[model samples]
Target: MLRAMRYLDYAATTPVLPEVTDAMVAVLTGDFGNPSSVHAYGRAAREIVEDARDRVASAVGASPAEIVFTAGGTEADNLAIKGATRKLRGNGNHVITTAFEHHAVLDTVEWLGHDEFETTVLPVGPDGLVDPAAVAAAVRPSTILVSIMAVNNEIGTAQPLAEIARAVKGANPSTLVHTDAVQMLGNLPVNVHELGLDFAAFSAHKFGGPKGVGFLFARSHAPVEALLHGGGHEGGLRSGTLNVPGLAGLGVAAEIAAKEVDHKIERVGGLRTRLWQGIEDSIERVRLNGHPTERVPGTLNVSFEGADGETLLLLFDAAGIACSAGSACQSGAIDPSHVLLAIGVPREIAKGSVRFSLGRESTDEDVDAVLEVLPGIVESARRVG
Candidate 1:
């Protein structure tokens, strides 16, 4: 007999909701038309895309005109980081970002540093936070853009984006600010204006929608150069045939996620606390990663003192549980998570950390299931290591 499988990796990705699936199927089966064409079929398809744009915008407190559809979070990050920097390069060539940002931001900034732009990669404290003062201090008159992530994907610590933005602006009013908010939307409240962000990136899959679709919130005044050149889609910023079915799914997912964020936060947060408390009570020499109070509710990163994280993950899989050692993007990498290292986790302890993320559908039973077997899993992993 097979053991029941429990999923606890929502930060990596989420299962598409039934409503989102229904919306996508409706589009794929019936509304198969080119949004750019003038025919009746095209008009219907265009409406689906536009409505989805509006839904996504409303979810993040943005205007439909400001939402630029992209392949996913990475594209959005590239557009926000590379496009913005390229467009504003004439004003300055310096860009600033923290060490804990998603690779989408860090790698892009690093790439730019090799040629056209001068980049500063700021450091974070052991608590996985970038000090706003540090960001302000890094600002030079030549700084054109500062890219930060609203949430750290590995540790689940929420950065002080508003404060950081304010600090950056105070230092250099001309400098544009961008945030990789892929891990933030649907899991937390994201208002572009309230956060004072010039650009923000989000992924639909993070919020119960399908993969391969996401959007960027670029304030009207904040112009970014086009990465793809074609039919001038997405206000000529991103060009390609829009994914009608994916857009439909994204809309429904964003709407539902926004509507239920408070409830999900409370419920999922309780489950996360329960799981952590259980592990703390049952296990010894374990450390909780990230902030205790100011993090997204669903993600819990924990380090076992003597157990290997990879071994624990494999053992958990064998026990019919699913989790990740770190960001899904860096699954096969040999180095300890850069996020962990930036936060000052010892190399060995960083290698022994696992990230367990909950979602709206996570339940007490899921918590109980993990609690039941985690002690044994850790013990076995320690022995093997």
Candidate 2:
């Protein structure tokens, strides 16, 4: 009902909640201060940041001392991969990750490869689940870090992190296990210790908080070197002046998400299933992407044969239904999705896929509207293609 279009791209970024916005506004106007300064204002700002860190940590079963705030998920991913690799330079120049990782992890590993480091990209099965055995087999004697995302952003596929972490640690006790948990934070239970991960990344905007705020969870024993060099902030692991207002919003959002995730999951999961069932009942020559049941409850990705994703997206837009061709960052590209291809989808169908992500705010009426609009859009796109 917004601008006559129904939004279905919550995975890309969520709208900030009114409570989170109010918290941020209070900080921006009333408690504005540089955390590094030596004054009452500075102390107040520092206290806010610290309390926010504690809330975020509690949400993920981490300690406040282990959380290092960053600009966003991408920066957190870069810091964890690059910083951990740099710290273990003497141990080896080898790292291991999955083929289906987001570009942040994939690109960082590619950059490391350019620097003479050997990287092994493990393959996922057609189910889009990485096998723990594959990771254990890929680990070389020189392997120093194993990084994997807790959930796939494109398809909402959940990786077996607990199994993967145990395998990595068993193969090489010194090797660090890092997971990008940005998409999994609000949708799933993310206990770092329970998952046996050394480091993990999260972003606020993914969970109805303000953007440009994220955190990296680093275990005490698996400390990474500072990626940014200045100001000695975040225990010298990430150095820069803190975003006080954004941090406050993040804290409020995290607490709200933690308290409401279970109920939200049930509601959104039902909506996602209704959408998927509607599509399946109406459409033909369509394939669902990712694992059948082992995915985030709020996301559904589907590939329609003989259709162009970009064309279908436009058709749906014209009909007042908002969806995505693929990842927001890669929307302009014409090539097939690497994530879809990794899961063994045909290139042509991959080119015709769209991701529909639901959120806590989605209603049954919104779900029905999409069901009414999408089949015709897909039919039209296929005929045109």
Candidate 3:
């Protein structure tokens, strides 16, 4: 007999909610048409895409016209940084970001350095939180843009976005602010104006929607240049034929997430607390990573001394538990997580880290299940070490 499978990697990706998948079937089966065509079939498809745009925009507290749909979070990030920075290059070469940002932002900033633009990677304190004062101090009159993530993917630390935005504007009003909010959109309340962000990127799959569909929120006042050039779709910013079925699914998911966010947060947060307690009660030489109180409720990263994270993850997999050693993006990479290193976690501890992320469907039993076997898993790994 098989042990019950437990999924603890919601942050990496979530299975599509049943309602969202059901909603997509209509578009997939019959309503499919090219959104750009001028015919009646196309017009109908256009409406579905538009409705999806509205739902997604409402979730983020932005207007639909400001939403530029892209392939996924990475594409959206590329568009926001490269497109926005392209227009600002004449003003200054400097752009500011944190050391713990996802590679989408980190690699993009570094690529800019290869050209005319310069990059400044700010440091985070031991709490895995960025200091607003550091942002204010780093702002140069030449600084044209600042891109920070609303949440760290690996460590799950929530940044002081509002505080940091104020620092950026207070230091240099000309600088535009952007955030990689893919991890934050459905999990937290996101308002572009309220959050003081000029640009934001999100992935649909991160919020129980289908993958390969995401959007960019570019404030009307802070326009981004077109990353792709062709049919001038998406207000001429991100030109591509719309994915009607994917949009429909994404819209439904966003609507559900927005309507049920508070309740889900409370539920998942409670389960996460239990999971943390379970591990602490059973495991020794383990330390929690990330901000203790200022993190998203669904995610917890922990380090086990004297054990290999890779081995622990493999053991967990064999025990019918799904978890992560670090960011899903870094899967198959042997190096310790950059987020852990930036937060001053020693290399040895970082090497043994594992991340557990809960979701709306997660239950108390799942927490208990992991708790039941984790001690053995850790002990087995340590003995082999």
Say which candidate scores most in lDDT.
1
TM-score against truth, every candidate: 0.98, 0.98, 0.98
Off by over 4 Å in 3: 1-4
Per residue, candidate 1 scores C-alpha lDDT tens digits across 77-196 of 999888988888888999999888888988999999987789899998888888999999999999999998999998899989999999999999999999999988878887999999
Model 2, 38-60: lDDT tens digits are: 89999999999999999999999
Q: Scored by Cα lDDT, where does model 3 land?
A: 0.90
Q: What's every prediction's RMSD, in angstroms?
A: 1.2, 1.1, 1.4
Question: For candidate 3, what is the TM-score?
Answer: 0.98
Worst 10 residues of 1 by lDDT: 332-341
Q: Against the correct fold, how does model 2 do in TM-score?
A: 0.98
Q: Report every candidate's CA lDDT.
A: 0.92, 0.90, 0.90
Error of 1 at 348 (Å): 0.7
